[model samples]
Target: MTSIGIVGSQGRMGVALAAAAAEAGHGHCGVDKDGDVGALAKEANVLVDFSSPAALEQTLDACVAQGRPIVIGTTGLEERHHYLIDDAAADIAVLQTGNTSLGVTLLAHLVREAAARLDPAFDIEIVEMHHRMKVDAPSGTALLLGQAAAEGRGIDLGDCSERGRDGVTGARGHGKIGFASLRGGTVAGDHDVIFAGPEEILTLSHRAENRMIFARGAVRAALWLLHQKPGRYTMPQVLGLGEA
Candidate 1:
């Protein structure tokens, strides 16, 4: 049985991960915010992190020091944090993503396929909603889906994407991907990718009913990462959805 250690043990995702681990018959070596992170890394077979961005660098350092694998589900990271994760992945396996739900992972894949098949005239737009407590806009998952769309259309998201438009904005530009975010209630997550054309519209969506799906997917990723060599990884690899 793999021994799992959790960071941010007191947070909502942390509690869910612990419960999911128990349900999967895995053992928890440590779960805490104040614990010796490096010690936990050394002792546990794998570490799952759903902590804050502030704790990211330190956690990556600890996992790297111990040559242990980690699955990261933290959101709202910046460029520096991504660079740090890339550096650490050279020493220890790391799987990082915005959302861990299997459905979302597959949804991203399908979005890519659809975007590739549709012409630029389809005008792709991504919309997402989360709980009011979430602070990020255009959520990490939305960006992930946008990236897939950009990849399919051979464009750069940073260069061709539009976000959070307000009044006085000009008409929608062709060949540009758009994003809209909504927050309220206790929504787990809801994402939709729409392809709008002159004649018709096609929308693809996924709604998460509970947070447990993410917890379960994170556990699955952690288990898969345990056997991988030192490198960066993604949920698509875990689910065998990589390009043929």
Candidate 2:
């Protein structure tokens, strides 16, 4: 049985992950702010971080110091945080993703495939909804789907992403991937990828009912990380959808 280390133990996802670890017949230890991160890393065989972006560096440092593999389920990360994850990945197994639910991972795969097969006349729009407490707009999962679409279309997401449109926006840019975010009552998560062609609309969606899906998926990812070499990984890889 693996000893799972939980970063942000007090958060919602952390609690769920602890329950998941127990259900999986694995032992777990957790740490929050002001806790002994290094000690936690040393005590556990692998780490799962569902913590805030601000604490990512410290969590990564502890994992690297102990040569532990980590599954990062944290959302709302910036470009700089990615650089930090990349640096740490050079020496340890790191699976970083915006969403961990297996269904969402599959949805992203399908979105990429659809984007590649459809003609440019189809306009792409991604919509996501989360709990009101969620701070990030567009949700990380939406961005993940956008990245897949961009890849299928052979374009850079940063260059073609159209978000936060308000008063007097003239027209959708050619080949733009549009995004819309909705925040409301206690939504676990919901994402829809819509492709509007000449006269038809194709929509792909995934709805998360609770935190357990993410928690269970993270455990699965951590299990995969254990046998992997030091490198960065993704949810798709965890599902064996290599390079899809």
Root-mean-square deviation of every model: 1.3, 0.9
Q: After TM-score superposition, what is the CA distance of residue 68 in candidate 2 from its true location, in Å? A: 0.3
**Model 2 Cα lDDT, one tens digit per residue, 148-175:** 9999999999999999999999989999
Error of 1 at 232 (Å): 0.5
**What's the lDDT for all of these models?**
0.91, 0.94
Estimate the TM-score of every prediction.
Answer: 0.97, 0.98
Query: Where does candidate 1 stray beyond 4 Å?
Result: none
Cα-lDDT of candidate 1: 0.91
Local accuracy of candidate 1 as per-residue lDDT tens digits, 125-199: 999999999998889899989988988998899999998799999999879999999999999999999999989
Clashes of each: 0, 0
Clash-forming residue pairs, model 1: none
- Model 2 weakest 10-residue run by lDDT: 235-244
Best by lDDT: 2
